[model samples]
Target: MKQLRVKVTNAVGLHARPAAVFVGEAGRFASQIRVRNATRNTPWVDAKSILSVLTLGVEPQHEIEIMADGPDDTRAAEALQQLIASDFAGKI
Candidate 1:
């Protein structure tokens, strides 16, 4: 298992397009990936679920935590970190 925190850097946060990118990337991994806001009450969401990510209502600079567990967990977490750090730029 692996976990890391990242800030949403996309000008509009993880809106439709960026969330789609994220979900696509997450789907490539054999690992299970989840993302969620740091706020305690929020539930962790499937990284492949665009609707779930949108429900997060992420905003610029909002910190999110990514968690992965499986054979590809490390790669999954790293890729997700890059996605967040890039503000979902090119990947979008």
Candidate 2:
């Protein structure tokens, strides 16, 4: 398994459109990915599910932890880290 912790810097944090973008990016990987709101000390949730991610209640400046386990775990973790690091960039 691979894991990373990153702070959310987007204006709206992970909600609505940003949540959708996050879920979409997570779906692109073959690895099983999970995320949790580190700042909130929330339980891990399915990164591919919008509902699950939304339950995290992530907000701007919140720190989140992501984990991936599978053949592409490393890439999956890194890609997600980049996505959040870039504030979802062009994808949002």
Candidate 3:
């Protein structure tokens, strides 16, 4: 299992578009991934699910924790961390 802590840099946070991007990326990995707001009381939610991610209420500058458990856990965690750190490439 692997875990990463990253701050969301996207201007609008993980809303619709960014959440969709994140869900797509997570789906590419053969691992179970979950996410939660690191600085809040939100419970961990399935990272690959758009609805679950959106419910997180993540906002810009919100620190989030990503956890992956499986053969590709490390890669999954790293990729997601990079994606959030880069603000989803300013796409959303």
Candidate-wise lDDT, in order: 0.87, 0.95, 0.92
Q: Residues 1-92, candidate 2, lDDT per residue (tens digit)?
A: 99999999999899999999999989999999999999999999999999999999999999999999999999999999999999898777
State, as a TM-score between 0 and 1, how close model 2 is to the true structure.
0.97
- Tell me how many clashing residue pairs each candidate has: 0, 0, 0
| Cα error of candidate 3 at position 86, Å | 1.0
TM-score of each: 0.92, 0.97, 0.95
Query: Model 3 over residues 1-92: C-alpha lDDT tens digits?
Result: 99989998778888899999999999999999999988776999999999999999999889999999999999999999999888787556
Total clashes in model 2, counting residue pairs 3 or more apart in sequence or in different chains: 0
Consecutive 10-residue window with the lowest summed lDDT within model 1: 83-92
Worst 10 residues of 3 by lDDT: 83-92
With candidate 1 superimposed using the best TM-score fit, by how many Å does residue 30's alpha carbon deviate from the native?
0.5
Clashing pairs in 3: none
lDDT of 2 at 40: 96
Give the winner by TM-score. Answer: 2
RMSD of 3: 1.0
